[model samples]
Target: MSGISIVGVGNMARALAARALAGGNAVEIIGRDRVKAEELAGTLDGVTVGTAGAAPAGDIVILAAPYAGAAEVVREYGDALRGRIIVDITNPVAPDLQGLVVPDDSSGAQEIAGLAPEGAHVVKAFNTVFSHVLAAGPAEGRPLDVFVAGDDAQAKARVSAFVAGMGLRPWDIGGLAMARALENVALVELGLMNHSVKHTDFSLGITLLH
Candidate 1:
């Protein structure tokens, strides 16, 4: 398992960090507020904390913030993030929950990729999985299905490896262009949670018949 640096102190960050630690990877928490970062790190044994703007110490950097925050973090990191695998886990749904905020042709992950440095490979994943579901472990003993999309093959492979190591299924859904579909799936899941299903601890999964 590779070391992971999560640039947020929220639920998603903690959920990912817990999985990383479980996979024997060192986890680092970086946030705009050093105190919040430290507090979150303290809750997780063996986790390190760093302030925002510091060069990420991990090979994989997970932007666990909201869409806007994620963009700001990437822009603030700038060239220092070159050559790092940036995991874009944000869903760009409208605040009203009616639809997506991005244009029809582009997805949040693609937009974030545009903001990244030349060498920074952006991989879109984990947006469909709810934080509470991740925290509660696999649903009904079935591993979560994590859909990943990225233009960089090696970066996607790395993310897939990490997901597998953490006992989840990683489905490579092709280039970053596929992120639009992935983000739409996230929006659907959110709508279900907020309406039909009314649950926050459920995750989307695929079951194949034997």
Candidate 2:
């Protein structure tokens, strides 16, 4: 089983932690508030908790925070996160939920990658899936699609493995530059959910007709 550490104790954190536990991965919750981290960890089996700034003990670390918070966490960790695959799962959507907050030239994942430690590879994934859908398992009787992008091939592969282990599909959409498109698509999905779709339980995936 993979060793995974998640930063933040919000809905996304809880959802991801639950999946990680179910996948038999060793999970750790590290939050800014130690009390909340401990509380969340206590609710999960074989999981641990720690405060922020401490060295991460897992090979894979998921940043289950908002776009701004994700950047701050990466900056704060600095070299302490070296040699770890840091998964940036934040969508930089506008507060009004109408569009993306990031410029067309960049993305939340790319910006977070800029602040990551030298050897800490930032792979974008899970931004397109909602927390509730993740908790409920596969979407529309199909496994969730996790779109991943990163500069490092090995890093992306590791993240893909983790996603597949959790019973989801990991689609490698190319290098880190593609993250901008991923975030933009997520914004579009939000728009659909708010207007036409009118639901948060759907996930986007390609249907192969072989």
Candidate 3:
């Protein structure tokens, strides 16, 4: 399994790091606050910690920050992320959860991709899963489906493999352009949570008639 570096110290970051470590992948947690990063690492056995500005030790770097801060995080890393697979897991939605905040033609992942250093491939994923559900593992005896969108086939494959390693399913929806739809998918999930679902334990999934 490929190693992963998660650049945040929040709930999503901790959930992902725990799953990656459970899958036997090398996991590194990075944050602007080294102490918080170290604290998160301490909770997970065998995980390493690094400061935000340092070059990540993993081949795949997950920008676990929110949509507002993701670009700045990437800019801070700069060329250090060159040739790495940058995973964007942000859903740029309005504060009231009424609509998306990004422009109609450009998604948050697209915006992040634009800021990524040359040679770095940006892949959109995990935006549809809630942090608590992810931390709790699969839902209703089924592995959660992680929707992936990226122009780079190899990068998507790597992410898919990592998802499978964590006992989940990865659905390669299409190129990065489809990231907009994925973001909307998250919005739909949130809408459901606020209305019908009334909870955060569920995740978006697909069922194929075989």
Model 3 per-residue lDDT tens digits across residues 1-210: 888999999999999999999999999999888999999999999999976888899999998989988889988889999999999999899999978888899899999999898999999999999898888988667878899999999999999999999988899999999999999998899889889989987877988889
Clashing pairs in 2: none
Candidate 3 residue runs with Cα over 4 Å from true position:
none
Better of 2 and 3 by TM-score: 3
Which consecutive 10 residues in model 1 have the weakest lDDT in total?
Answer: 132-141
lDDT for predicted candidate 2 compared with the true structure: 0.89
- Report residue 138 deviation for candidate 1 (angstroms): 1.1
Which scores better on lDDT, 2 or 3?
3
Give a tens-digit lDDT track for model 2, residues 1-210. Answer: 889999999999999999999988999999998999988888888889866998888999999999888889998989989999999999888889877787778888888888887888989999888899888888557778889999999999989999999988889999999988888888888888988999986878878899
TM per candidate comes to 0.97, 0.96, 0.97
Give the poorly placed runs of model 1, Cα more than 4 Å off.
Answer: none
Model 2 CA lDDT for position 28: 90
Residue 149, candidate 2: how far off, in angstroms? 0.8
User: Which residue ranges in model 2 land beyond 4 Å of their true spot?
Assistant: none
lDDT of 2 at 195: 89
